[model samples]
Target chain A: QQPVQSPQAVILREGEDAVINCSSSKALYSVHWYRQKHGEAPVFLMILLKGGEQKGHDKISASFNEKKQQSSLYLTASQLSYSGTYFCIEGGSNYKLTFGKGTLLTVNP
Target chain B: EPEVTQTPSHQVTQMGQEVILRCVPISNHLYFYWYRQILGQKVEFLVSFYNNEISEKSEIFDDQFSVERPDGSNFTLKIRSTKLEDSAMYFCASNLDREPRAFFGQGTRLTVV
Candidate 1:
């Protein structure tokens, strides 16, 4: 089954912070994060392979908790460019991936 | 930065017809994948290929859907008989290896009428 992402949509003023979460019923092997603008393909962000793995890129960061079967993406000092739908994809063995519905983040200036 | 490239940014085809979506993955990348997103829906995985063969495929990939790496540079997905529901943005992706942080192409918007 596909993972589940919370807060289907979020609106934030520029420079504000926001958090999007993803969870699954089964333990995930690896999790990948991506941001996609409308009418475009998903842009690869980062991947968390091991439990408790955390990664950051610019002001965006993500963490995975093995016990919770969950992952969280943190956007700090958000920028207008960060306005897009975020998807957390669960990667299984042999590179299989299942994507969540997505979390739409709108950052307004 | 080399990136995955897909051709025919947009394609409109009639139902019951055949369509082929093409992609050129980043040079030196060994893994290739195909994914699709219905308008306003989640991106769904269709198939993954490695070593010139399909490594894994989702249930969404049925007999009608086929993938082929016809040459060293071109990977293609063929739909034998398109359906109205096949209309979606199909994305081609590639990665180096098992540690799959795949780079995606611009995508082909397939509109089956």
Candidate 2:
């Protein structure tokens, strides 16, 4: 099944902060994060393994909670370039990925 | 700096016709995948290939859709008979191994009429 992402859309000003979360009911082997610009393909951000580790890109960071089957992405001091749609794909033991509906983020200056 | 590359950035074909989207994954990557996104829809995985064979596939990857590693450098997705619903952005991706960080191509914008 696809993971569930919170806050269908978020609006923020430059330098503001926001958090997007994804949760799944199945046992997850990995959680992947990607950002898609308008009318473009999704760009890879980072991946979190089952070991409950976190990865980051500049001010964008993510955490995976192995026990909770949840992951959270944090965007701090956001920039206008950060405005885009964020998607989380959950990979379970089966090695197949189910993606969420996505969270649309708009960061304005 | 290596990234996945796809050809025919945009393709328009009539229904019942066949279409083949090509991709060249990172030179050293062993795992390849095909995914599609219907307009305004979430990206859906079609299939994954490893060891020159399909490792996993989704129900969407029915008989109409097939993937092949035709040669040492090319991976292709062939849609035997195009349908209007097949109009979407088809993306090719590759990974270093079983790792979750997948590098995606610029995508082929398939428009079936």
Candidate 3:
């Protein structure tokens, strides 16, 4: 099943912070984070597995909670470049990914 | 860095016509996937391929849809009969293993008219 992402859209000023949440009804084997700019492909950001290890990319980070079937992506000191649609994909047992509707993040100058 | 590559940045096909979208996954990647996104919508998974066969496919991948790894490096998705609803940006992705972190291509914009 597709994961549900909260805060359908968010607006932040440069140097501000934001948090996006993704939750699924079914059990998740892994959670993948990707960002897509207008007219561009979704770019892989990070992947969180069931073990609950937190991963980071520069000012962005994510954590996976197997018990809650949820994952959260944290963006700190957001930059203008961070403006895009962020999606959290729930990986199935067969390695197929069901992606969420995505959260539109807009970082202002 | 290694990245998946898809052919024909954009394709325009007539209804009822057959179209084949090609992709070249990262050389070392073992798992391949096909996903499509309609205008202003979420990316939907169509199918996944491994070991030269389809490992999984979604309901969206129906009788008119098929996938193949024609050679060592090329992966393709064929639509037997294109429909207006099939117009979307199709992305090809690959991962080194089953864990995660898939690299996606630029995507092919398929417009069925």
Task: Give the top-scoring candidate (lDDT).
Answer: 1
Q: TM-score of candidate 1 restricted to chain B?
A: 0.97
Once superposed on the true structure, which residue ranges of model 1 sit more than 4 Å away at CA?
A66-68
Clash count list over all predictions: 0, 0, 0
Model 1 chain A lowest lDDT segment of ten: A90-99
**What TM-score does prediction 3 earn?**
0.95
List candidate 3 stretches off by more than 4 Å.
A66-68
What is each candidate's DockQ, to 2 decimals? Answer: 0.79, 0.63, 0.78
Model 1, C-alpha of B54: deviation from truth (Å)? 1.7
Per-model chain A TM: 0.96, 0.92, 0.94
lDDT per residue (tens digit) for residues A35-65 in model 3: 9998899988988885567889799999988
Off by over 4 Å in 2: A92-96
**Leading candidate by DockQ:** 1
Taking chain B only, the TM-score of every model is 0.97, 0.97, 0.97
Per-residue alpha-carbon lDDT of candidate 1 for residues B5-94, written as tens digits (9 for 90 to 100): 999999999999999999999889898999999999999899999998999998989999999999899999999899999999999998
Model 1: colliding residue pairs: none
